[model samples]
Target: MPSGESGHALKVESWGDPSILVTEFPDIEDFHGQLIETVLRLEQDPEFTRHFDGHVGESKVYHVERWDCPAARLIDARAKALFTSALKKENAVVDLSWASVYRAGNYCLPHSHFRSAASLVYFLDLGDEEAGGRFLFTDPRLKICCRHEPGRMTYPVGPQVRPGILMMFPAQCVHMVTPYHGTRPRITMSWNIDDKALPGNPLPN
Candidate 1:
């Protein structure tokens, strides 16, 4: 939360897997303002549709790749710091980055990112508190339980729906979003980092 510092880390309860990390940042680097503004501007831009895809018309998967995220530089540095600190991967570079706007009825299907060591989702804006739009992740233990398990998480799904929150996990983890019925739109930015991208003293690299 200091100068040149990234966001404040939040605790992510872990299970047996040590390669897992679920960190929450408290907007320590001031990336939230820029992140939200970029999406808002894109929504009004005539060509916004051309630069992004997913949930464009009939589709519901939001993805923007032609232009890097507005806060790419800051995100890159902070993300590297966090990833290396959590996963011990250094010299990390963002291989892919994009922004998405989720309006009413928009939802993402279950999927995992490919060709990357980790995947991150930064919550730029959460439209409504009652819209019931929640981030869902598959159980890491491969459980198919429809009910809660004892001495552990009972549900097979995990949810995190909050603004100014950044969620990171293994690239191979499957996740999705529930339908957003809120009147206001939800904005978010996501990216993946390749293990091969990091190869030096992360700070100077």
Candidate 2:
């Protein structure tokens, strides 16, 4: 996409209510090397555990925040360009973080990002079948105990968030990972974005 047409635009659709679509914009800015290297370094870092207080011992959710890190800057630059080219309406800023899961039963609780205007998850390493890890996105089913209306909640979910794939969505959407039975570990990087942090790049406005 041309830089001129790469300005920000409305990237969401709806099914009665607005729905965020998974978009694919070419990695024209060349952040692939940086993204891959960052994931590798972070995975190998001994201090990787330090940033994951939320999922340290018993918890399924563990995360690390690497603010303004060199790799994060590159990720942000690529994300900004894509946001401009694809989501012309939204000025999206990138906030960097990573998530780690170590066991078969590890899974993330369904929740939304409170501080971000939008959120993204980049698949890094996916554990084996025993790990049983799968990224799930569902419609409103506020109570797990109660039955949701037919077709309201999508179960088991669609699309396995595979490596090299970057998934972006509205920040408030509730999503989670299904427990993996695989013995290996599952890791993913995430970023948050908001209007203010996002630079102004209009889509022919």
Candidate 3:
């Protein structure tokens, strides 16, 4: 388990063959309001359009590291710490950091971030509990989906979605989000991190 800045141990739960670490960020009520507002504002920025690619209607992924906000900075710092703890290395660097806001009908298709060593996601908002935007991981063994038994197709994996929960998993793990049906937007921040810096991709100063 990783200790917070105040020296309190943060609870971490791990599961699955390759293992996924789920940690509840301490005292999220302190800054979630500000963080959510910042994310919503960034989602509307026209500049993010240039960075858009892949699924045409998926939520826009904005590089929030360039923004000079305390909420974003706090998330970046905590994400890097969690990434380092998950990799068991002291020098983890975030190669890519972005935030996404999922409104009604927004969903991510199955994809993998094969370029990075690991990936991190911080749930800023989960909308309604009944909303159907659960994050799921496809069984790595493609043949497993051919089985007719229950729970053999895809794994919901990780803890239930809620604000302040941070999950770190292998970058190559295939994952996707279910279509969201809530009136309120689902917000999340993500980072692609590795033990060492990449060649062309420079770490944010």
All candidates' lDDT scores? 0.59, 0.51, 0.72
**Which of candidates 1 and 3 reaches a greater TM-score?**
3
Give the clash count for each candidate: 3, 20, 0
Specify the highest-lDDT model's number.
3
In model 3, what lDDT does residue 183 have? 81
List candidate 2 segments past 4 Å from native: 1-18, 23-74, 89-91, 99-102, 141-151, 154-156, 198-205
Worst 10 residues of 2 by lDDT: 53-62
User: Rank order by lDDT, top first?
Assistant: 3, 1, 2
The worst-scoring run of ten residues by lDDT in candidate 3 lies at 49-58
lDDT of 3 by residue, 1-205 (tens): 4565677878777745446788887778888888887767766677652222323224555576777688787778888888776667888777887776776777777877746889888888888778878887775443333255644664444356678889898887777888887888787888888988787743332
Summarize candidate 1's per-residue lDDT along 21-132 as a digit string, tens digits. 5555665346667756666666665554332233321121233444356564565565566666666665566666656677787777776776678887777677788785
Candidate 1's C-alpha lDDT? 0.59
Candidate 2 CA-lDDT value: 0.51
Query: TM-score for every candidate vs. truth?
Result: 0.69, 0.60, 0.83
